[model samples]
Target: MRSRRAPLLIAAVVAALLTPAAAAAAAPAPAAQAVVASCSAAAWSGSAVYVGGNQVTHGGAAWRAKWWTQGETPGTTGPWGVWERTGTCDGGEPPIDPPGTEDFPVSQAQFNQFFPHRNSFYTYSGLVDALSAYPGFANSGSETIQKREAAAFLANVSHETGGLVHVVEQNTANYPHYCDTSQPYGCPAGHDQYYGKGPIQLSWNYNYKAAGDALGIDLLNNPRLVQTDSAIAWKTGLWYWNTQNGPGTMTAHAAIVNDRGFGETIRSINGSIECNGGNPAQVQSRIDTYLRFTSALGVDPGGNLRC
Candidate 1:
Protein backbone atom coordinates (compact mmCIF):
# COMPACT_ATOMS: atom_id res chain seq x y z
CA MET A 1 0.00 0.00 0.00
CA ARG A 2 2.87 2.44 0.95
CA SER A 3 4.78 1.62 -2.25
CA ARG A 4 1.60 2.07 -4.30
CA ARG A 5 0.97 5.41 -2.55
CA ALA A 6 4.57 6.57 -3.23
CA PRO A 7 4.22 5.74 -6.93
CA LEU A 8 0.93 7.62 -7.11
CA LEU A 9 2.47 10.73 -5.38
CA ILE A 10 5.40 10.74 -7.80
CA ALA A 11 3.02 10.35 -10.72
CA ALA A 12 0.81 13.25 -9.37
CA VAL A 13 3.82 15.66 -9.31
CA VAL A 14 4.80 14.70 -12.86
CA ALA A 15 1.15 15.12 -13.98
CA ALA A 16 1.04 18.69 -12.50
CA LEU A 17 4.14 19.73 -14.49
CA LEU A 18 2.79 18.07 -17.65
CA THR A 19 -0.61 19.81 -17.28
CA PRO A 20 1.00 23.30 -17.25
CA ALA A 21 3.11 22.48 -20.33
CA ALA A 22 0.02 21.20 -22.17
CA ALA A 23 -1.99 24.29 -21.19
CA ALA A 24 0.80 26.59 -22.33
CA ALA A 25 0.94 24.79 -25.70
CA ALA A 26 -2.90 25.00 -26.05
CA ALA A 27 -3.06 28.75 -25.07
CA PRO A 28 -1.40 29.92 -28.31
CA ALA A 29 1.74 32.11 -28.05
CA PRO A 30 1.10 35.80 -27.39
CA ALA A 31 0.92 37.55 -30.74
CA ALA A 32 3.86 39.82 -31.48
CA GLN A 33 2.81 43.53 -31.61
CA ALA A 34 3.24 45.01 -35.08
CA VAL A 35 6.05 47.53 -35.23
CA VAL A 36 6.04 50.86 -37.08
CA ALA A 37 9.49 51.63 -38.38
CA SER A 38 11.00 55.00 -37.67
CA CYS A 39 11.31 57.50 -40.48
CA SER A 40 14.70 57.74 -42.19
CA ALA A 41 16.50 60.06 -44.58
CA ALA A 42 16.71 57.44 -47.35
CA ALA A 43 15.89 59.07 -50.67
CA TRP A 44 13.07 57.67 -52.78
CA SER A 45 13.88 56.19 -56.18
CA GLY A 46 11.58 54.64 -58.76
CA SER A 47 14.00 51.78 -59.30
CA ALA A 48 14.41 50.86 -55.58
CA VAL A 49 12.07 48.43 -53.83
CA TYR A 50 10.39 49.63 -50.65
CA VAL A 51 8.43 47.71 -48.00
CA GLY A 52 5.53 48.85 -45.84
CA GLY A 53 6.56 51.45 -43.20
CA ASN A 54 9.59 52.55 -45.25
CA GLN A 55 10.14 56.31 -45.48
CA VAL A 56 11.92 58.36 -48.10
CA THR A 57 12.15 61.86 -49.53
CA HIS A 58 11.27 62.96 -53.05
CA GLY A 59 10.54 66.42 -54.44
CA GLY A 60 11.66 68.01 -51.14
CA ALA A 61 9.01 66.18 -49.14
CA ALA A 62 8.98 62.96 -47.09
CA TRP A 63 6.70 59.97 -47.64
CA ARG A 64 5.96 56.52 -46.22
CA ALA A 65 4.80 53.48 -48.16
CA LYS A 66 1.69 51.61 -47.00
CA TRP A 67 2.82 48.43 -48.73
CA TRP A 68 5.63 46.95 -50.82
CA THR A 69 6.50 48.69 -54.08
CA GLN A 70 9.35 49.18 -56.56
CA GLY A 71 8.42 51.57 -59.36
CA GLU A 72 5.94 53.86 -57.59
CA THR A 73 7.15 57.31 -56.50
CA PRO A 74 6.89 58.21 -52.81
CA GLY A 75 4.65 61.25 -53.00
CA THR A 76 2.02 59.80 -55.34
CA THR A 77 -0.94 57.53 -54.61
CA GLY A 78 -2.09 54.97 -57.19
CA PRO A 79 -2.48 51.20 -57.98
CA TRP A 80 1.18 50.57 -57.04
CA GLY A 81 0.05 51.10 -53.41
CA VAL A 82 -0.56 54.28 -51.49
CA TRP A 83 2.38 56.36 -50.25
CA GLU A 84 1.47 58.86 -47.54
CA ARG A 85 3.06 62.26 -47.22
CA THR A 86 5.07 62.18 -43.99
CA GLY A 87 6.69 65.63 -43.88
CA THR A 88 9.71 67.42 -45.20
CA CYS A 89 13.08 65.75 -44.64
CA ASP A 90 13.87 68.53 -42.20
CA GLY A 91 10.74 67.57 -40.16
CA GLY A 92 8.53 70.47 -41.36
CA GLU A 93 6.85 71.78 -44.47
CA PRO A 94 9.40 73.14 -46.87
CA PRO A 95 9.25 76.88 -47.52
CA ILE A 96 7.10 77.96 -50.49
CA ASP A 97 10.40 78.68 -52.18
CA PRO A 98 14.02 78.33 -51.10
CA PRO A 99 15.32 80.91 -48.64
CA GLY A 100 16.97 83.35 -51.07
CA THR A 101 14.54 82.71 -53.93
CA GLU A 102 11.15 84.31 -53.14
CA ASP A 103 12.16 86.09 -49.94
CA PHE A 104 13.53 89.29 -51.50
CA PRO A 105 11.04 89.13 -54.44
CA VAL A 106 12.93 91.38 -56.84
CA SER A 107 16.02 89.78 -58.43
CA GLN A 108 19.53 91.16 -58.07
CA ALA A 109 19.31 92.50 -61.62
CA GLN A 110 15.93 94.12 -60.91
CA PHE A 111 17.27 95.70 -57.75
CA ASN A 112 20.38 96.84 -59.62
CA GLN A 113 18.23 98.36 -62.32
CA PHE A 114 16.10 100.07 -59.66
CA PHE A 115 19.14 101.60 -58.05
CA PRO A 116 22.02 101.52 -60.51
CA HIS A 117 24.00 104.24 -58.75
CA ARG A 118 23.46 102.44 -55.43
CA ASN A 119 26.47 101.52 -53.27
CA SER A 120 27.90 98.20 -54.49
CA PHE A 121 27.91 96.87 -50.93
CA TYR A 122 24.19 97.48 -50.25
CA THR A 123 23.18 94.43 -52.27
CA TYR A 124 20.19 92.12 -52.60
CA SER A 125 22.38 89.37 -51.15
CA GLY A 126 23.13 91.66 -48.20
CA LEU A 127 19.35 92.07 -47.62
CA VAL A 128 18.29 88.38 -47.85
CA ASP A 129 19.47 87.49 -44.36
CA ALA A 130 17.73 90.41 -42.69
CA LEU A 131 14.53 89.92 -44.69
CA SER A 132 14.52 86.19 -43.88
CA ALA A 133 14.65 86.90 -40.17
CA TYR A 134 11.57 89.06 -40.34
CA PRO A 135 8.49 86.79 -40.38
CA GLY A 136 6.57 89.46 -42.28
CA PHE A 137 9.02 89.44 -45.19
CA ALA A 138 7.69 86.77 -47.58
CA ASN A 139 5.15 84.68 -45.67
CA SER A 140 3.02 87.67 -44.76
CA GLY A 141 0.21 86.88 -47.25
CA SER A 142 -0.54 85.84 -50.81
CA GLU A 143 2.08 86.31 -53.54
CA THR A 144 0.29 89.52 -54.57
CA ILE A 145 0.09 90.61 -50.94
CA GLN A 146 3.73 89.69 -50.45
CA LYS A 147 4.80 91.65 -53.51
CA ARG A 148 2.92 94.68 -52.31
CA GLU A 149 4.30 94.43 -48.79
CA ALA A 150 7.78 94.06 -50.21
CA ALA A 151 7.24 97.02 -52.47
CA ALA A 152 5.99 99.07 -49.55
CA PHE A 153 8.94 98.08 -47.36
CA LEU A 154 11.52 98.67 -50.09
CA ALA A 155 9.92 102.02 -50.90
CA ASN A 156 10.44 103.20 -47.34
CA VAL A 157 13.93 101.77 -47.29
CA SER A 158 14.67 103.49 -50.59
CA HIS A 159 13.59 106.78 -49.11
CA GLU A 160 15.68 106.14 -45.98
CA THR A 161 18.83 105.09 -47.83
CA GLY A 162 18.53 107.28 -50.93
CA GLY A 163 17.72 104.28 -53.19
CA LEU A 164 20.19 102.05 -51.33
CA VAL A 165 23.01 104.56 -51.69
CA HIS A 166 23.71 105.22 -48.03
CA VAL A 167 24.33 102.62 -45.34
CA VAL A 168 24.56 105.06 -42.43
CA GLU A 169 22.61 108.25 -41.81
CA GLN A 170 23.74 111.04 -44.12
CA ASN A 171 23.13 113.86 -41.69
CA THR A 172 25.97 113.49 -39.23
CA ALA A 173 24.83 116.54 -37.26
CA ASN A 174 21.75 114.67 -35.94
CA TYR A 175 23.83 111.73 -34.61
CA PRO A 176 24.22 112.75 -30.97
CA HIS A 177 20.51 113.66 -30.63
CA TYR A 178 19.45 109.95 -30.81
CA CYS A 179 20.75 108.93 -27.39
CA ASP A 180 18.14 109.03 -24.64
CA THR A 181 19.53 109.63 -21.16
CA SER A 182 16.14 108.84 -19.61
CA GLN A 183 16.44 105.12 -20.35
CA PRO A 184 17.78 102.92 -17.53
CA TYR A 185 20.38 101.13 -19.77
CA GLY A 186 21.88 104.56 -20.47
CA CYS A 187 23.44 103.98 -23.88
CA PRO A 188 26.16 101.40 -23.20
CA ALA A 189 27.47 101.89 -26.80
CA GLY A 190 28.36 105.54 -26.00
CA HIS A 191 26.33 108.69 -26.71
CA ASP A 192 26.74 108.92 -30.46
CA GLN A 193 27.28 105.34 -31.75
CA TYR A 194 23.53 104.76 -32.04
CA TYR A 195 23.08 107.21 -34.87
CA GLY A 196 20.80 105.91 -37.63
CA LYS A 197 22.35 102.87 -39.35
CA GLY A 198 21.06 100.19 -41.76
CA PRO A 199 18.29 100.39 -44.40
CA ILE A 200 15.75 102.17 -42.19
CA GLN A 201 18.59 103.98 -40.44
CA LEU A 202 17.96 102.43 -36.99
CA SER A 203 18.70 105.20 -34.56
CA TRP A 204 18.94 105.79 -30.78
CA ASN A 205 20.36 103.62 -28.02
CA TYR A 206 16.98 102.32 -26.78
CA ASN A 207 15.97 101.33 -30.31
CA TYR A 208 19.33 99.67 -30.90
CA LYS A 209 18.91 97.76 -27.63
CA ALA A 210 15.39 96.68 -28.52
CA ALA A 211 16.31 95.56 -32.08
CA GLY A 212 19.47 93.79 -30.80
CA ASP A 213 17.44 92.05 -28.11
CA ALA A 214 14.87 90.82 -30.62
CA LEU A 215 17.56 89.73 -33.15
CA GLY A 216 19.86 88.15 -30.49
CA ILE A 217 22.65 90.67 -31.04
CA ASP A 218 24.29 93.10 -28.61
CA LEU A 219 23.69 96.41 -30.33
CA LEU A 220 23.56 98.16 -26.97
CA ASN A 221 27.24 97.42 -26.39
CA ASN A 222 28.31 97.22 -30.03
CA PRO A 223 26.10 99.58 -31.96
CA ARG A 224 28.72 99.83 -34.71
CA LEU A 225 27.77 96.29 -35.79
CA VAL A 226 24.80 97.89 -37.58
CA GLN A 227 27.25 100.07 -39.52
CA THR A 228 29.93 97.41 -40.07
CA ASP A 229 27.94 94.27 -40.97
CA SER A 230 25.64 94.68 -43.94
CA ALA A 231 23.42 91.84 -42.75
CA ILE A 232 23.16 93.30 -39.28
CA ALA A 233 22.44 96.71 -40.71
CA TRP A 234 19.55 95.43 -42.81
CA LYS A 235 18.25 93.41 -39.87
CA THR A 236 17.89 96.63 -37.95
CA GLY A 237 15.84 98.03 -40.81
CA LEU A 238 13.57 94.95 -40.91
CA TRP A 239 13.31 95.09 -37.15
CA TYR A 240 11.96 98.60 -37.42
CA TRP A 241 9.73 97.72 -40.36
CA ASN A 242 8.19 94.67 -38.72
CA THR A 243 8.08 95.70 -35.06
CA GLN A 244 7.81 99.42 -34.45
CA ASN A 245 4.84 101.64 -35.35
CA GLY A 246 7.02 104.74 -34.95
CA PRO A 247 5.49 108.03 -33.67
CA GLY A 248 2.41 107.90 -35.93
CA THR A 249 0.52 104.58 -36.34
CA MET A 250 0.33 100.79 -36.93
CA THR A 251 3.26 98.50 -37.60
CA ALA A 252 4.36 98.41 -41.22
CA HIS A 253 3.64 94.68 -41.09
CA ALA A 254 0.09 95.33 -39.89
CA ALA A 255 -0.36 98.12 -42.36
CA ILE A 256 0.16 95.82 -45.37
CA VAL A 257 -1.27 92.43 -44.31
CA ASN A 258 -4.43 94.09 -42.99
CA ASP A 259 -4.76 96.03 -46.27
CA ARG A 260 -4.74 99.29 -44.34
CA GLY A 261 -2.98 100.72 -47.43
CA PHE A 262 0.61 101.83 -48.09
CA GLY A 263 -0.09 105.32 -46.92
CA GLU A 264 -0.77 104.00 -43.41
CA THR A 265 2.65 102.38 -43.50
CA ILE A 266 4.10 105.78 -44.32
CA ARG A 267 2.15 107.14 -41.39
CA SER A 268 3.52 104.30 -39.29
CA ILE A 269 7.16 104.66 -40.24
CA ASN A 270 7.61 108.45 -40.31
CA GLY A 271 4.28 110.24 -40.18
CA SER A 272 5.77 112.49 -37.55
CA ILE A 273 8.17 113.86 -40.14
CA GLU A 274 6.46 113.10 -43.45
CA CYS A 275 2.67 112.92 -42.94
CA ASN A 276 -0.04 115.58 -42.35
CA GLY A 277 1.77 118.47 -44.05
CA GLY A 278 5.09 117.68 -42.38
CA ASN A 279 7.07 116.92 -45.55
CA PRO A 280 5.21 116.38 -48.83
CA ALA A 281 8.39 115.85 -50.88
CA GLN A 282 9.64 113.07 -48.60
CA VAL A 283 6.24 111.33 -48.69
CA GLN A 284 6.13 111.63 -52.49
CA SER A 285 9.58 110.08 -52.73
CA ARG A 286 8.40 106.95 -50.89
CA ILE A 287 5.22 106.78 -53.04
CA ASP A 288 7.24 107.09 -56.25
CA THR A 289 9.46 104.20 -55.26
CA TYR A 290 6.45 102.11 -54.28
CA LEU A 291 4.74 102.81 -57.65
CA ARG A 292 7.91 101.93 -59.51
CA PHE A 293 8.24 98.67 -57.58
CA THR A 294 4.59 97.72 -58.16
CA SER A 295 4.98 98.47 -61.86
CA ALA A 296 8.01 96.23 -61.94
CA LEU A 297 5.97 93.49 -60.26
CA GLY A 298 3.16 94.11 -62.83
CA VAL A 299 0.51 94.76 -60.16
CA ASP A 300 -1.93 97.59 -59.65
CA PRO A 301 -0.38 100.23 -57.41
CA GLY A 302 -3.68 100.37 -55.45
CA GLY A 303 -5.05 103.53 -53.84
CA ASN A 304 -3.99 105.82 -50.97
CA LEU A 305 -0.41 105.99 -52.23
CA ARG A 306 0.24 109.03 -50.06
CA CYS A 307 0.01 109.62 -46.32
Candidate 2:
Protein backbone atom coordinates (compact mmCIF):
# COMPACT_ATOMS: atom_id res chain seq x y z
CA MET A 1 0.00 0.00 0.00
CA ARG A 2 3.05 2.32 0.18
CA SER A 3 3.50 4.79 -2.61
CA ARG A 4 6.68 4.45 -4.76
CA ARG A 5 7.31 8.21 -4.31
CA ALA A 6 7.40 7.84 -0.46
CA PRO A 7 10.96 6.30 -0.49
CA LEU A 8 12.24 9.04 -2.77
CA LEU A 9 10.69 11.75 -0.52
CA ILE A 10 12.20 10.24 2.65
CA ALA A 11 15.68 9.91 1.02
CA ALA A 12 15.51 13.56 -0.12
CA VAL A 13 14.61 14.76 3.44
CA VAL A 14 17.50 12.69 5.00
CA ALA A 15 19.99 14.11 2.47
CA ALA A 16 18.86 17.71 3.27
CA LEU A 17 19.24 17.15 7.07
CA LEU A 18 22.83 15.72 6.72
CA THR A 19 24.15 18.27 4.18
CA PRO A 20 27.59 19.88 4.89
CA ALA A 21 26.04 23.24 5.89
CA ALA A 22 23.46 21.51 8.08
CA ALA A 23 26.12 19.41 9.82
CA ALA A 24 28.33 22.40 10.35
CA ALA A 25 25.49 24.33 12.01
CA ALA A 26 24.75 21.41 14.34
CA ALA A 27 28.35 20.81 15.54
CA PRO A 28 29.91 22.50 18.61
CA ALA A 29 32.11 25.53 18.00
CA PRO A 30 35.91 25.26 18.35
CA ALA A 31 37.58 26.58 21.54
CA ALA A 32 39.51 29.82 21.52
CA GLN A 33 43.32 29.54 21.30
CA ALA A 34 45.45 30.08 24.38
CA VAL A 35 47.66 33.14 24.55
CA VAL A 36 51.33 32.36 25.02
CA ALA A 37 53.67 34.67 26.92
CA SER A 38 56.59 36.04 24.91
CA CYS A 39 59.95 35.64 26.68
CA SER A 40 63.44 36.59 25.45
CA ALA A 41 65.83 35.39 28.21
CA ALA A 42 68.21 32.50 27.49
CA ALA A 43 67.15 29.08 28.72
CA TRP A 44 68.64 27.52 31.91
CA SER A 45 71.39 24.95 31.65
CA GLY A 46 71.88 22.13 34.13
CA SER A 47 75.63 21.75 33.52
CA ALA A 48 76.35 25.42 34.10
CA VAL A 49 77.10 26.58 37.65
CA TYR A 50 75.12 29.47 39.14
CA VAL A 51 76.29 31.50 42.11
CA GLY A 52 74.09 33.52 44.42
CA GLY A 53 72.19 36.30 42.63
CA ASN A 54 72.73 34.67 39.24
CA GLN A 55 69.85 35.02 36.77
CA VAL A 56 68.50 32.37 34.45
CA THR A 57 65.50 31.62 32.27
CA HIS A 58 63.21 28.63 32.22
CA GLY A 59 59.64 28.11 30.95
CA GLY A 60 59.46 31.65 29.61
CA ALA A 61 60.03 33.17 33.06
CA ALA A 62 63.14 34.80 34.45
CA TRP A 63 64.57 33.43 37.73
CA ARG A 64 67.35 34.38 40.10
CA ALA A 65 69.41 31.84 41.98
CA LYS A 66 69.80 32.20 45.73
CA TRP A 67 73.02 30.21 46.05
CA TRP A 68 75.33 27.86 44.18
CA THR A 69 73.54 25.37 41.95
CA GLN A 70 74.28 22.93 39.14
CA GLY A 71 72.25 20.18 37.47
CA GLU A 72 69.07 21.63 38.98
CA THR A 73 66.47 23.20 36.74
CA PRO A 74 64.64 26.30 37.86
CA GLY A 75 60.92 25.88 38.82
CA THR A 76 61.51 22.12 39.05
CA THR A 77 64.16 21.75 41.79
CA GLY A 78 62.64 21.77 45.24
CA PRO A 79 62.94 20.55 48.89
CA TRP A 80 66.73 20.92 48.39
CA GLY A 81 67.45 23.77 45.99
CA VAL A 82 67.70 27.51 45.10
CA TRP A 83 65.89 29.57 42.40
CA GLU A 84 63.64 32.61 42.73
CA ARG A 85 61.26 33.87 40.05
CA THR A 86 61.91 37.45 39.07
CA GLY A 87 59.16 37.66 36.47
CA THR A 88 58.24 36.87 32.90
CA CYS A 89 61.06 37.91 30.56
CA ASP A 90 58.80 40.45 28.95
CA GLY A 91 57.63 42.03 32.23
CA GLY A 92 61.07 43.39 33.16
CA GLU A 93 62.58 43.68 36.63
CA PRO A 94 60.56 44.94 39.54
CA PRO A 95 61.58 48.20 41.18
CA ILE A 96 64.11 47.40 43.92
CA ASP A 97 65.12 50.00 46.51
CA PRO A 98 68.81 50.40 47.24
CA PRO A 99 70.00 48.00 49.96
CA GLY A 100 69.89 49.59 53.39
CA THR A 101 69.02 48.72 57.01
CA GLU A 102 68.47 52.24 58.34
CA ASP A 103 65.82 50.60 60.50
CA PHE A 104 66.17 47.06 61.82
CA PRO A 105 63.26 45.04 60.51
CA VAL A 106 62.10 43.46 63.77
CA SER A 107 61.86 45.21 67.13
CA GLN A 108 62.99 43.17 70.14
CA ALA A 109 59.46 43.35 71.52
CA GLN A 110 58.04 42.01 68.29
CA PHE A 111 60.56 39.20 68.22
CA ASN A 112 59.76 38.40 71.84
CA GLN A 113 56.04 38.30 71.09
CA PHE A 114 56.58 35.44 68.65
CA PHE A 115 59.29 33.63 70.60
CA PRO A 116 57.88 34.18 74.07
CA HIS A 117 60.13 31.54 75.57
CA ARG A 118 63.12 31.96 73.25
CA ASN A 119 66.30 30.66 74.79
CA SER A 120 68.19 33.36 76.71
CA PHE A 121 71.34 31.96 75.11
CA TYR A 122 70.02 32.97 71.67
CA THR A 123 70.11 36.75 72.12
CA TYR A 124 68.40 38.63 69.25
CA SER A 125 70.94 41.48 69.04
CA GLY A 126 73.79 39.02 68.57
CA LEU A 127 72.27 38.28 65.17
CA VAL A 128 73.08 41.84 64.04
CA ASP A 129 76.75 40.88 63.67
CA ALA A 130 75.83 38.02 61.40
CA LEU A 131 73.50 40.27 59.44
CA SER A 132 76.12 42.99 59.10
CA ALA A 133 78.62 40.49 57.80
CA TYR A 134 76.28 39.21 55.09
CA PRO A 135 75.83 41.84 52.37
CA GLY A 136 72.29 40.71 51.56
CA PHE A 137 70.95 39.91 55.01
CA ALA A 138 67.88 42.06 55.66
CA ASN A 139 69.64 44.76 53.65
CA SER A 140 68.54 43.86 50.14
CA GLY A 141 65.63 45.56 48.37
CA SER A 142 63.03 47.79 50.06
CA GLU A 143 62.22 48.26 53.76
CA THR A 144 58.87 46.50 53.32
CA ILE A 145 60.61 43.56 51.68
CA GLN A 146 63.13 43.36 54.56
CA LYS A 147 60.41 43.28 57.23
CA ARG A 148 58.55 40.52 55.38
CA GLU A 149 61.78 38.57 55.05
CA ALA A 150 62.52 38.90 58.77
CA ALA A 151 59.01 37.77 59.68
CA ALA A 152 59.12 34.83 57.29
CA PHE A 153 62.55 33.76 58.56
CA LEU A 154 61.61 33.85 62.25
CA ALA A 155 58.24 32.23 61.67
CA ASN A 156 59.91 29.11 60.26
CA VAL A 157 62.47 29.15 63.06
CA SER A 158 59.70 29.45 65.62
CA HIS A 159 58.03 26.33 64.26
CA GLU A 160 61.36 24.46 64.05
CA THR A 161 62.27 25.24 67.70
CA GLY A 162 58.74 24.91 69.10
CA GLY A 163 58.21 28.65 69.61
CA LEU A 164 61.94 29.02 70.26
CA VAL A 165 62.08 26.79 73.31
CA HIS A 166 64.54 24.14 72.12
CA VAL A 167 68.01 25.19 70.96
CA VAL A 168 69.06 21.62 69.98
CA GLU A 169 67.04 18.69 68.78
CA GLN A 170 65.13 16.94 71.54
CA ASN A 171 65.33 13.50 69.95
CA THR A 172 68.87 12.21 70.37
CA ALA A 173 68.41 9.04 68.35
CA ASN A 174 68.77 10.94 65.04
CA TYR A 175 71.96 12.78 65.93
CA PRO A 176 74.38 10.13 64.76
CA HIS A 177 72.75 9.81 61.36
CA TYR A 178 73.58 13.43 60.42
CA CYS A 179 77.25 12.53 59.95
CA ASP A 180 77.64 11.42 56.37
CA THR A 181 80.92 9.47 56.14
CA SER A 182 80.90 9.71 52.37
CA GLN A 183 81.60 13.45 52.52
CA PRO A 184 85.23 14.18 51.54
CA TYR A 185 85.72 16.54 54.47
CA GLY A 186 84.65 13.79 56.90
CA CYS A 187 82.80 14.44 60.13
CA PRO A 188 85.49 16.45 61.91
CA ALA A 189 83.26 17.31 64.89
CA GLY A 190 82.54 13.66 65.68
CA HIS A 191 79.41 11.74 64.65
CA ASP A 192 76.60 12.83 66.95
CA GLN A 193 77.19 16.57 67.44
CA TYR A 194 75.83 17.52 64.03
CA TYR A 195 72.22 17.45 65.17
CA GLY A 196 69.96 20.48 64.84
CA LYS A 197 71.28 23.69 66.43
CA GLY A 198 70.75 27.47 66.31
CA PRO A 199 67.60 29.32 65.16
CA ILE A 200 67.51 27.41 61.87
CA GLN A 201 68.56 24.32 63.80
CA LEU A 202 71.26 23.61 61.22
CA SER A 203 71.75 19.87 60.86
CA TRP A 204 74.20 17.46 59.18
CA ASN A 205 78.04 17.45 59.03
CA TYR A 206 78.21 18.96 55.54
CA ASN A 207 76.02 21.90 56.61
CA TYR A 208 78.34 22.74 59.48
CA LYS A 209 81.33 22.57 57.19
CA ALA A 210 79.71 24.67 54.48
CA ALA A 211 78.39 27.25 56.93
CA GLY A 212 81.77 27.42 58.59
CA ASP A 213 83.50 27.77 55.24
CA ALA A 214 81.15 30.60 54.24
CA LEU A 215 81.44 32.35 57.60
CA GLY A 216 85.19 31.73 58.04
CA ILE A 217 84.79 29.53 61.12
CA ASP A 218 85.73 25.97 61.95
CA LEU A 219 82.22 24.68 62.62
CA LEU A 220 83.10 21.18 61.48
CA ASN A 221 85.93 21.05 64.00
CA ASN A 222 84.07 22.93 66.75
CA PRO A 223 80.37 22.27 66.32
CA ARG A 224 79.56 23.53 69.81
CA LEU A 225 80.21 27.10 68.72
CA VAL A 226 76.54 27.11 67.74
CA GLN A 227 75.59 26.38 71.34
CA THR A 228 78.29 28.28 73.27
CA ASP A 229 78.86 31.45 71.21
CA SER A 230 75.53 33.28 70.86
CA ALA A 231 76.62 35.52 67.97
CA ILE A 232 78.27 32.65 66.18
CA ALA A 233 75.21 30.48 66.72
CA TRP A 234 72.99 33.17 65.21
CA LYS A 235 75.52 33.73 62.47
CA THR A 236 75.19 30.08 61.50
CA GLY A 237 71.42 30.53 61.21
CA LEU A 238 71.73 33.73 59.16
CA TRP A 239 74.41 32.17 57.02
CA TYR A 240 72.04 29.30 56.32
CA TRP A 241 69.28 31.76 55.55
CA ASN A 242 71.10 34.32 53.37
CA THR A 243 73.52 32.01 51.61
CA GLN A 244 72.57 28.35 51.73
CA ASN A 245 69.44 27.01 50.05
CA GLY A 246 69.27 24.14 52.55
CA PRO A 247 66.55 21.78 51.22
CA GLY A 248 64.69 24.40 49.24
CA THR A 249 64.51 25.82 45.75
CA MET A 250 65.12 29.37 46.88
CA THR A 251 66.81 31.01 49.85
CA ALA A 252 64.34 32.16 52.52
CA HIS A 253 65.28 35.74 51.56
CA ALA A 254 64.23 35.16 47.93
CA ALA A 255 60.89 33.67 48.93
CA ILE A 256 59.84 37.02 50.36
CA VAL A 257 61.53 39.65 48.20
CA ASN A 258 61.33 37.86 44.88
CA ASP A 259 57.52 37.72 45.10
CA ARG A 260 57.40 33.93 45.07
CA GLY A 261 55.34 34.31 48.31
CA PHE A 262 55.90 33.22 51.89
CA GLY A 263 54.68 29.73 51.15
CA GLU A 264 57.67 29.20 48.88
CA THR A 265 59.92 29.76 51.89
CA ILE A 266 58.27 26.86 53.69
CA ARG A 267 58.80 24.74 50.60
CA SER A 268 62.37 25.98 50.47
CA ILE A 269 62.96 24.98 54.09
CA ASN A 270 60.94 21.77 54.61
CA GLY A 271 59.02 21.07 51.44
CA SER A 272 60.28 17.54 51.00
CA ILE A 273 58.45 16.32 54.11
CA GLU A 274 56.07 19.18 54.87
CA CYS A 275 54.87 20.14 51.40
CA ASN A 276 52.66 18.29 48.88
CA GLY A 277 52.94 14.62 49.84
CA GLY A 278 54.17 15.06 53.41
CA ASN A 279 52.22 16.59 56.32
CA PRO A 280 49.67 19.39 55.88
CA ALA A 281 49.34 20.00 59.62
CA GLN A 282 53.07 20.67 59.92
CA VAL A 283 52.97 22.93 56.88
CA GLN A 284 49.94 24.75 58.27
CA SER A 285 51.72 25.32 61.56
CA ARG A 286 54.48 27.13 59.71
CA ILE A 287 51.95 29.10 57.66
CA ASP A 288 49.95 30.06 60.75
CA THR A 289 53.07 31.41 62.40
CA TYR A 290 53.97 33.28 59.20
CA LEU A 291 50.51 34.87 59.05
CA ARG A 292 50.75 35.98 62.66
CA PHE A 293 54.21 37.44 62.16
CA THR A 294 53.22 39.17 58.92
CA SER A 295 50.09 40.53 60.57
CA ALA A 296 52.12 41.79 63.48
CA LEU A 297 54.49 43.54 61.10
CA GLY A 298 51.61 45.24 59.24
CA VAL A 299 52.59 43.76 55.86
CA ASP A 300 50.29 41.91 53.55
CA PRO A 301 50.74 38.16 53.84
CA GLY A 302 51.01 38.20 50.02
CA GLY A 303 49.86 35.25 47.87
CA ASN A 304 50.47 31.47 47.91
CA LEU A 305 50.25 30.85 51.66
CA ARG A 306 50.34 27.09 51.21
CA CYS A 307 53.12 24.93 49.86
lDDT of 2 by residue, 124-170 (tens): 66765567667676667887787788888888888988877788989
- Runs with alpha carbons beyond 4 Å of true place in candidate 2: 1-102
Locate the minimum summed-lDDT window of 10 residues in model 1: 89-98
The C-alpha TM-scores of every prediction are 0.66, 0.65
Candidate RMSDs in order: 18.7, 21.4
Q: Give the poorly placed runs of model 1, Cα more than 4 Å off.
A: 1-99
lDDT of 1 by residue, 136-156 (tens): 674667777888887888888
Q: In lDDT terms, how accurate is model 1? A: 0.77
Give all candidates' CA lDDT scores: 0.77, 0.77
On a 0 to 1 TM-score scale, where does candidate 1 land against the true structure? 0.66
In angstroms, give how far residue 77 of model 1 lies from its true place. Answer: 44
